[model samples]
Target: MRPVPLVLPLAGLPHRVPGDTDAVVVGGGVAGISAAVVLAERGVRVTMVEAADTLGGRLGAWPHTLPDGTRQIVEHGFHAFFRQYYTWRAILRRADPALGFLRPVVGYPVISRRWPDEDLTGLPAAPPLSLLALFVRSPSLGLRDITGADRSLALELLGYHRERSTPALDAMPAGKFLDRFGITERARSMLFEAFARSFFCDPDALSAAELVAMFHFYFLGNPEGLGFDAPDTDYLSCIWTPLADHLTRHGGRIRAGAAADTVEPADDHRWRVRVAGGAQVTARHLVLALDPAGLRGLAERSPGLRRVGPALAERAAGLRVAPPFAVSRLWLDRDVAPGRATFSAVTGEPTLDSVTCYHRLEEPSRRWAATTGGSVLELHSYACVEPDAAQATARMRDELAALWPETRDAVVRHQLCRYEATAPSFPPGAAGARPTVQTDARGVRVAGDFVELPWCAGLMERSAMSGILAANEVLAEEGAAAEPVHGVPQRGLLAGWTPMTRRRR
Candidate 1:
């Protein structure tokens, strides 16, 4: 089942001898780990520092014990790995040649409680056909609904060009854009809103450009269909642990529980990073792969970062963090109906956005369910309106009970709720303000999902892409060829013409 390891073909640059170049990567998330791995593969000495005791920042997991002493690594929420994630898949393939850890979820199902049978499934994979099929088959949409939409904007959906179309779109809010199109309220609630919430932003608050770009990235530009894959087991074991192993095997040092306090240029022109516990790491290059909040914190607290300039600090401070998101996991004393989907997006719920029956989707959960004759379900809420976790969890539990009557009587054996303010906001006109991987500061680079990238991607893919770009910047400075980065194309036939191009005719 294992595939051969694909080697990077860097032209004109011989792999440097090990330990010749040194890099200090701040943060041990996917981006930091990815940067470290690429550098180490090129024979550079990499030192990765993580604030938490374990790797995988927002993606990290912790062990939880069941009543019977069985332990499992519980994560913050469900993470969907789309097939379009080429860069992330490449990194994973290096660690797991077989790519056996991923399990595909058949279709993108959006479920509604008001009409239980109205869930979206089995739509055609290819576009134009996919759009046609969805409109025809969906209970919430109809030919009449399409007729009501803005003729030009509706036609533009099938052929959005990132470069030509997004600049104008970026100036407007998604809600206003949809209003111009006169898109049906049902279509807005069922599809557009769901997608917007996925990014943890309100539809009215998000930029139309971001929505169009994401549509192209997830649908039009994607070679792989809309279906996504999840880990066969917990991410800690299948993902982060394997990546950590790969980094170490490639001569990189991973220092967990090491909180970097300052990163300043030393007299020798090497970057000197000091950790909270007085540990110091000096390297020729420094990659600040921290999250949005982390970056802002470093800019405020680290005097070394101030040396980069007032502009870097100002930019960090200006970056926006999305509203808080929440996740709840419940161990029910009964199984859901066999007909229930493994994963489903929910509508008509105030706080709940999606639900996943882990016992049905994951093998370990299935085995545990078999023994207990019960199920484990994880529910997620993005940009939750609830003021606190207790209220959020209560509302979600009630919604679950109403959706699946079996859960009303089933006893709750164990439950966990988590809330965090981490997602990057993509508000109107925000794209132009996002930071790039390469900075003006010497020996310094930044990597995160929020950073601006040349190609179109979001979430974990964006994180990995930024990391690779940061590493490539350093590689380029050393006169070595940069690594290849992949992206899904966004320019379609109808989208090829911009307002300027059309006006020229």
Candidate 2:
């Protein structure tokens, strides 16, 4: 089956491409590329401008090769998606078949320095079973309370609705969500901790709504794919490189190092986009695919846009993304033990949120898992804990020492990558709160994971989906055949929860 129809309208754009071209998408990440590709496929001449030399903003710098020459195809930070990541899965399936998908027998891993009292070896059949297994095997749960109240709590969460009179949103702290659900401290530390660390934010700092939505999307949905796995190529090769190549192949121009300095509206709503070190490129319609905050300085130069700029700025500012985090790489002298990509390791203060032995997942011959000699071992640390560069770097080194003290001597090489404000907290209302792809003003559009697949929509898939929606809407208004399928206005399964589904334009 095809992906669910997801098209966010980039309506209200004035058609004036000068030539036959339809739109100009700014920012060369997944969003820009997706929009551009979709538009090109639908017979629109599209120009995509990227500020950086490469595409795939956060996704570009990942899948690092190790010292032993073994590659651990890890994300900059640990990020994996569920089966319901329809946009992501569809892209990968089109790109390569070898990146196979797998379903984990367990939900989140329960790890400790010592083996637990109950060994959860047998995989459960479904989510409820898996949750039951987790509660039974986990160390932190209070048996009586969990057995009594937790089931109801889980149901409530899985079936949460904004109109359901649940006061979960008012409880800002994610910790409260766990507490209210009677999740044992062990479950909190093991399962919730890893998920929160995936955000790279503090549990206390995260909104309960965001946490709840994420939990349901990632863990409870699909019965298998949430924490399940399918082999997948790195995000760059599958999404960014292909897009850049596509743009280049189509005679579309992309200038690297050309940061947008200002956006000014011409006499008839045409956009003049001035670049940092290049000539101004004019287009009929312009897309500010950038996170709103990134455009603050540029908006200052244009008249009649100053007022609109700050409001956009507020959307950007108010959007609380996961704080910056450090991705640490370690090159090992010897091969790592073989195993499945793991989210295990229940610890007191979890250093690494989740560990994936990329070598194991992507390569069997590499002879290492998370650790690689001629290989690479990747570790993701919480950004909130280590916000600054110095602290992040030092802490990663310290983490290396702590995890494998003996490996310190055999370390062949190391590298550190830090991504700031990497992903937004995609709670439920956040999607509704997402700024429209079309703004109130003229000659402007927005496209990002934040705009389309707002709930936990960080990966290239969401970006692509958003871009496609934006481009499709723009082209449709220009009298082009709109290939994108919009979401059915009528409610179907689970449509009761989505506000967007209830309303029709």
Candidate 3:
């Protein structure tokens, strides 16, 4: 089946020559790379500039030497590859046609300190049945809990009515929606709240519409089940380096460590982007595949961007960033029990939200574990309230000990902690205000997870999808066929039984 068409309306862009140096794509994240790759494949000369020395942006990793003289590549955190991420998979397939670098995670495991040994597995793969199995088998939930839920909200969640339900869900907070539907406090905390917080947004602050959309995307609408996959190695070797090679092979230029300081319109009608250290390049089209903060910084510093007028400035100014999040990785001198899960969702912990046994899941770490008989664990905290890295790390360690007592005695051989502000917040009523791929400024497009995508995907998938849409926007202006973007169907059974079915009968 063909992918869904994006609803990007670029009415007034002027056609331009698709020649060498035709486009300058800023920010070398997934979005930037995706855009650059598409442009280069279409025989458009594209120059990609990245502030960091690497091309992965948030997905970038840096090498760190352990005290024992071993080196490892430290990353921001773990990333899950859901099956519905068609565009991202397609992009990866361009480099590695076989997609041999990914490893599947067999089951979804949600754990709590209150019951560390509990087996929260065996939920059926298919939905309605899966939902039923979960409710039936869960130790925390009961029949009364399901019966007490508000019928209308439950129906809206299970019954697919995109036109009528999307706006209604968008108007309320996810926490409020759960409370209104009478979802039990324990059930909410264990499942819904944990899932919401995993995305770095508190349930009370995030949009109910976004939560519902994710439910459909990851659980209900999914064809490959709720299980996810992850890269078998560091993102640098597996994803970024390969993509960079692919882009260059397709005739695209990449400039690492070249930070674009400002982007302004030149006298010749082309956009002049000035990099740090006095380097400058002019291109016919510019794609700002930057994060919200980066975009704001560009607009604030560049007189050219400001001169584009109030509409673009207002949209950029209105963008909201979520609170800071933190990731901590520990190298222990002892191994976790072999039977313990490789990855798990954590609740009832003060600072730790999830944990991954990298030694079990990643090939490099697995080989290291075999040699040293040790373990490598990564802990994550979303929307962290800690004031400093030390405090966050301390809390995470203590919580980790609480959940897995073995960690308390495991000697730390090496450790790394990172705290930074990341991802855009999806607050109640924030959907309509989010920017799209096309901006009011001519020849300028934006791509990021925060941008309003036509499809219901978020995080890394959203970033890649937005990149595809951004490139297509420029292609449409050049009178080229827009690239197809894929999205999973949201309406399951309802999709098969349309009004036309009744009319035909």
Q: Which numbered prediction scores highest in TM-score against the true structure?
A: 1
Candidate 1 lDDT tens digits, 205-270: 888888888876776656665778888888888888888998899899989999988877787778
lDDT by residue for model 3 (1-505), tens = 2234444334554333254448899999889988998888887789998998877877787677878777777676888877668878888887689888888876567788665333344445556776676678775567877778886666666654455446667879988988987877677777777788877878888988888777766656655566678888887778888999999998889999998999998865589899999999888889998888888778888877878744676777888888788888888899987667878888767678888999877766777778899999998888787887778988988888877888898988888888888678889987768778888878888898888876787588889889988888778877666666777665644433433233445
Cα deviation of 248 in candidate 1 (Å)? 0.2
Clashes of 3: 0
What's the true lDDT of residue 403 in model 2? 49
Model 3 vs. true fold: TM: 0.91
If ranked by TM-score, best first, what sequence of candidates would result?
1, 3, 2
Q: What is the TM-score of each candidate against the true structure?
A: 0.93, 0.77, 0.91
Candidate 2: tens digits of C-alpha lDDT, residues 1-505:
1233544434554333223655677787667766666666555666777776666666553455654475544444435555455555544444444434333334345444433422333435345555556567556554754653455445645554433312436345776667766765655665676566565567766667656555554444333333445334455555556656766666566766677877776665577787887578887777777644454444555554545444554454455565666666554455444443244432444355434444444443234533334444565666446656656655655654554455355554555556366565554344455556766656577777666342333344456666766775667667654434332111112424433223321
- For model 2, the superposed segments whose C-alpha errors exceed 4 Å read 1-19, 62-78, 92-153, 162-171, 227-235, 295-304, 307-313, 339-347, 361-373, 397-409, 425-434, 452-461, 481-505
RMSD for all candidates, in order, please.
3.1, 6.0, 4.3
Using lDDT as the measure, which candidate wins?
1
lDDT order, best first, reads 1, 3, 2
The better candidate by TM-score, 2 or 3, is: 3
